[model samples]
Target: MRLYKIMIVDDEAEVRQAIARKIDWRAVGFEIVADAENGRDALEKAETLELDVVLTDIKMPFMDGLELGAELARRKPNLKLIVFSGFDEFEYAKEAIKLNVVEYVLKPVNAAELTAILDRVRGTLDAEIEQRRNIRQLTQAYQESLPLLREKFLLDLLRGPMDPQVLEAQAERFGLAVREGAYKVAAVCDIVHGGEGRPALSDELVPVSVRQMLSDALWDRCGSEIVLGVPSILVATAWERDPVESLMRLLGEVCTECKRILGVTLAVGIGRPCQSLAELCRSCAEARTALEYRAVVGLGKPIYIQDMERLDRTAPEWDGHREQQLLSVIKFGTREQIAAMVDKLLSDGEGEWSDQSRVLGILGTLLSILRRCRLGEEAMLGPRGSWIKLLAEDAPMEALRDWLLSVCLNMSGCMDQRRVSTAKRLVEEAERYIREHYPDSGLSVDRLCEHLHISQSYFSTIFKQETGRSYVQYLTDVRMEHAVELLRATDDKTYMVAEKVGYDEPNYFSYVFKKRFGVSP
Candidate 1:
């Protein structure tokens, strides 16, 4: 409903006033701004005033209608023009057509007829405005998507370690012309804060600032580089002849800037140089390893793959004695002792290693010891009973150490409170397995004992000792519960319920159901 500004032009003031008063210009989506006595004066006002529509009489003394329309068209090509002429000659009509005039109205013009001409001109103006607005909006949206597109491209490149030809094709398509050279992956990360699993809201903008600063600083050294924002680090892929030196220079420049702007120093990690795009994943892994080194090398410090390799040459291999002592505490020590072991593992240099696989192997060893010691509680680690559930490479070391401490203490507490032998845990695990596999007709105590690598006699003794019921009784109880629910909640036949709960013989199922519930099916 926005009104387009209108300008009236004629030799006589009476004619201009009559035209302006002939219609409610506001209702027709046009606003009358000013009146001019001649074409020469109207041209000046049209140029300076930013008028949208011009209504002018053709017969004027200086600079007649056709000459004014042509000059205005050359100057303000977007302005809508309507010509008012008493003479309906071919020359005037042809000249108006050449100037792209929108409408030609005969003067002593009819009010209703001129009003229709003005309405059509108003529609034309509205359409032009809408088209320009749409173009501007599309331009703004495309500008905003550039950063997100760049981030997605970088992440996908590293994840794929994409084939070189495919990588080249994608780079060309996305307008990223990465130079062909050896490349290293570098990451800038915030220092771990207060054992939280992730960074605080105040630190969320740090990665964006880090990416911008690093990309700007490295522009001189590496012409083409990709900076991406990720959860744990601001990842950058820069290609250069001397990648190691480039990474160090990048680290020195950005770390100082981060400290100055963010009020916190950033930890830097640089991966080894890789020759091809296919090797990017390996470089990315090495970069994460370097980042994890902040745990030992100290925060706000840079770590390189070569530095880790040089340190690994002299650092003793896994300390079997220390690992054994740690495992012993996890198996039977008090809560305080277990907590002390976890704190030492994270705070001291007990778990440091140049090879990431070795650290994971040591973690696997800890998990094995817990399993062997019968750590049989769901809440020991987290809601889901998988040990590796929360053990992500990007997880804060302090948080992971806290998790280990809590689980170890829970296991140690269990060992102290009850005679939870391996055999007892075995039987309890069998019961759990049975609950999950109750629909399988092949499930039996013999099969479970075989799977657990224990004698049937020993398994039976501990199964009863732990559960206070025979395995058959426990399985029957689970099946009966399922069958009763199916019977009440479903329209399924008795035979279908029997088969669903692992009873092939429907008659025997009905007999047992009556015995348990004291009712018929």
Candidate 2:
């Protein structure tokens, strides 16, 4: 029940008071917010107060009520006008009708007639509000049906190399303002799949819940976080630049709150910031790529493109053989094998990407792995992979690789979590395999599982349970201990030292050692 705010206008102060006192305003869903001496004062007050109705007398000084009514009707057509004049001239009545208010009132105004008219005004206001509300809901529904439009627009903006004028016009069509600033696209798709009790394939409400939180949290700084996800998953998109930290922080807060209240875990991928829509598209692709690593980092966390970029920078130069082996894992590997393979591929490259061209080449090799998997081609043909156009190009060595890896992982169904009961025997077998093969430079959790003919994800989980450390960490501990013993007992070149410890790249081997021992070999 909304109160229709109103104002009373009369030249004489007594008449205005008499009318105001005669009515029980609250009873009729109206409130007399102000009383003006004449139409001029009433107009000023109406503008300031944004009143809903104006009650005026035709006779007044410094602007009469009829003149005031005409002016107000032009400016605020929605405002209801009730005029009571002493003169009963037909010309005045005709002019009053043109003003388009409630109705012209005759003086001395009757209390009941004015009261009934005020009631009518309240009803009109109520009806108008309801109509507007209905229109908004309908608009939202229509928008929902055409999500592909927004997605395509966003996809084009993110895919890159579009003419600026064209992209700007497309953005305008979607009600998006492409402001000039370094905008980063964050892909929030990496949702953590929990164990048995984790809600089975989230309800559609999951997407709705996230969008609501985003609206409440981001307000005007962002557009609606359109759900760019499949039925089982919730992938969302957002682009931001100014106050990047605030955006991230707000997202993090929403993630935490959603997890607590809605039992949802979200992984956010922050892209490298870039100016212009094309670059932003590349950044978006990079974000989606970073999102693929969220599984490696576990759930309930935000992954930044900076973190992935750092990994790309520090990772050892690409290994073709290792990459081929990774492709094999993707082909035959279980969920865990694919997960561990991705981890090993990245981990082995720690501290290796030094040259830009080399990084570009390595990134190409990574994308090639996806192409071999055909996951890239599949997604490229789908609605989501418009940005996959760059299979291999100079590409600034940035997003194409990340996009490929993300798409491959998505296709591998790496999020395809297979819950296995932790078993003591499984852990013991993993430990035995590691102790025997920790010295093999090519040995990995994936390989260890393959040798044991166990599910990689299952083996890794149980092994973590028994050994209290990841297989990689446990293996590193063994190698580092041996390296320390060798450093103490005999003199060997650092590269030789690294090789004996099962690290093919001596620099990477050193990184692991320094991380463990806090000193370079």
Candidate 3:
């Protein structure tokens, strides 16, 4: 709706005036804002005026249009420039292109040709403005609705046992398209330990930005867009093309790049390929299952689902005794006791068992207990303690039990030196907080900021910089881990566990839990 301001620069006043008068500028939504008789004068005017397009003659006193154009470009990259030259020289045209001039017209320009050039430049400017606006809108929307969109995306991908068509349609709606073929899901895990005195990793792992880079990289390599389901990066490519190998290599490269460029550590787990979108849920499950092996496998390493042997049915079923023991160690045991128990479990070698599955199961059970305990505490502590309700949730006991065992098994292997001690310590501190006060409904960034005696922005930046995770993400991880515990150890309803974990809304809680574990809580 606004008029584009145009500027004309030429050595001769007649030439500049003649060209300006020839065009019906108003009809084309343009206004001739200024005229300069030389390049030096043109440069001065460009700096002073907010001009959209500059038409200049190549030859001028004091400053040649070429030099002036170059300087203008340096000062304002977004400024559109057009050059007119008496000499039809290829060198001048090439220089104009290098300076990113919008167009080059010869002296005594044909009216029709000049009009066509103007039309083309106008179209380009319009498109650029539109793209910028779209990007802004999308970015704003994403920022305001991040938590909700993230939960929904992960829920749809991990839970819902949905039909293949439905899944594909969902992907399409999100602007993610995958070809019909084998696909694998990858979970990127960043661990932050308290008392590490190191920078947080959150700034380095902005899901949207990371997704954009990954999508661009994958699209360039495979000619298809990468479907990003946060914490989970999904790539759909042909098995014959060796999508797994490609994915592993890509993740490895990405990790190395992040470390080199951003000073961050990342662990990636890749699930086996699923033939159809319906089976993608399983793939999601496998990727999360692999994350439990972080300690043993080492951080910043890529773990593949196929690398892990399938669970043997002949193994002894996980009993409540071990679950209770693990829970006790987590709840009240000393660090040494917990460490020793973890080491013993890792070395026990349950023989080709579903180690990943077991860890998720244990986490689920522990979270459930924590949730219930928090809920009861809330009742006793009154409204001030009611905050705990925000982090509690009800999950499927059977599925959670299975997931906990996998988590425990996986964690047992993680006690090695490869898992940075500082990172581990920070994670421990954060975990402790989640366990003790998850029921606090007011447990949020503002409260945490006040408690830490830091600005919210700085606290958020530092927390993410150190942990490689946002506060919400880390909290969700802890809560979901507890959800798995509840799902296994009790007959409590799913919604109840959801509430117990501090989730006021069961549906939203389930969505978040499922996204984390690749199965409905």
Candidate 4:
């Protein structure tokens, strides 16, 4: 078992030495880490060293025992305090209770009483240490489940009309690097069979190999997130500038390299760049559309949607069957699913103003669904009967489709706000936990998540997303801040300062200190 460190303080060196020698501290699971001649000296040492218990006299030179105990209690709420005074005054005892001193005794301390106090502190610390171990185990298990969570998140991002706020929050929780830039999504389709004949390769291994190749190529790129897609490997790339030419070149090389090295031909569909992740679904849809043209564009090629000349086909004739399907999806499907159905419903009808009746029918059905859900027309369309004026405005078919999508998404947002609120609350609770428990050296992702009753992967992702820093980084920053404060206030050695701030290893603390502040502790 790890020993609990104890500090002794009194005005006289003789009294301090006598208390230090009175008990066999090590035999009783305590170590005399330091001794101070006065309350002032003890407070300075206590600020520097990580102490579990303090044995002190009530009356001392610069500061009294109750004052020292109050300061220690404020600085380290977990520290156990023992105050000894010759006076049996009621005021002193009342003050000890206010300061939360653990033990009170007459001066010329008794060895047996001190030993009992040390034992109680040890038991308390041991229980806490065991709880921390359990937290570590829970956190480790949660971490092991992250791969599946990541895959799910990536799938959602692809099939998205995800709220941009939620998207960024979830992305951060998953440790994905997202920024404001040109975002384009690429889909990698395996053509080993479609290219020539099926290669003598395992179907699973093919995607695994392709994903690895994509990672290797993308490692130095601006920023990228890749996941094994349903039928293709999906990659989302963010570049600081328009990367149309650069993306084509890189994916074209990936296709060639796959065929040359693995004897597998790959067809890559590149989407047009958009300004934000919110527009990735549109880009993703376009990429899938480009892949469909591989029959005419040729197999085993990298297809860019921007380079395609789409045929000016008219919107499909809406039948009773299609209208019901759209209504059903609008009522219950995800925002992505609803937008996709709407996009298909509006396609090729760009200049067909005569299709206004069909558009109105779709909007009417949506308004009815909102009404069924107990939502007012104004809640979705911004005014009680403004949808009529909107239709009368003679908007383009594409613009009308976008407006319809917004109506469907507005309802979905109402249904989904509960989840967003939950995520925000979880983040708030986590930040509070970290700030309060930074002194515990074992404070970690597992411990924090366990406290929040959440999975490690989720807490890790959302914490990073909300704070823009990983848990480990954030904890280190908290520790470093306290370390700096102690260094500035007292002449404590580097190792003592390290102990005070939760680092077990002084050298490691110095390394982190220098990295964060450009100077050693």
Instruction: State which candidate has the highest lDDT.
Output: 4
RMSD of each: 32.1, 27.2, 25.6, 23.6
Stretch of 10 with least lDDT, candidate 2: 414-423
Candidate 1 runs further than 4 Å off: 1-149, 163-165, 191-204, 223-226, 311-521
Q: Report how far off residue 292 is in candidate 1 (Å).
A: 1.0
Which residue pairs in candidate 1 have backbone atoms (N, alpha carbon, C) closer than 3 angstroms, thus clashing?
none
TM-score, every prediction:
0.33, 0.35, 0.34, 0.33
Q: Please give the CA lDDT of all the candidate structures.
A: 0.63, 0.60, 0.57, 0.67
Tens-place lDDT per residue, model 3, 1-521, is 55788898887888887888788887776889999876656775775576778888787765678888887765555578888777666465656557658788886777788888998888887775444334555466446643555447646665436766766776666654443445534344443233323422343334444455455445545534344454455544434354654566566555544443234566666666656656656665556555555544556656764443222112112235665567445434445666555544433275333343444443455455444223232232235323233123333433433333443333433322223453344445555676677866457755664454333333443366677887777777777877788899999998899887887767667656765778886
- Candidate 4 residue-wise lDDT, 118-168, digit = tens: 777778767644443343443554355338877898778876578888888
Overall local distance difference test of candidate 2? 0.60
Per-prediction tally of clashes: 0, 7, 69, 2
Error of 1 at 45 (Å): 68
**Which candidate would rank higher by lDDT, 1 or 3?**
1
Which TM-score value belongs to model 1? 0.33
The digit string of per-residue lDDT tens for model 1 on 255-325 reads 64455334456777666666665566566655665565454345654666444433222312223555656
Best by TM-score: 2
**Residue pairs in clash, model 4:** 173-461, 173-462
Residue-wise C-alpha lDDT for candidate 2, range 1-521, written one tens digit per residue? 55777889997888988898888999999898899877756776765465778888888765777789887865454567877877655356556557556767678778898888888878887764444334355355435644687767765555445888887788777765444334535454444546435532245445555555555666555543344455322223345544444455566556654564456677776565555555665555556555655545455545655533332333122234656566445534566776565444444367332334444454566566544433344543344345434543445433543553564466555323311212555567677777777778878765776665544433554577667886766887888988898888888988888888787878667766776778888
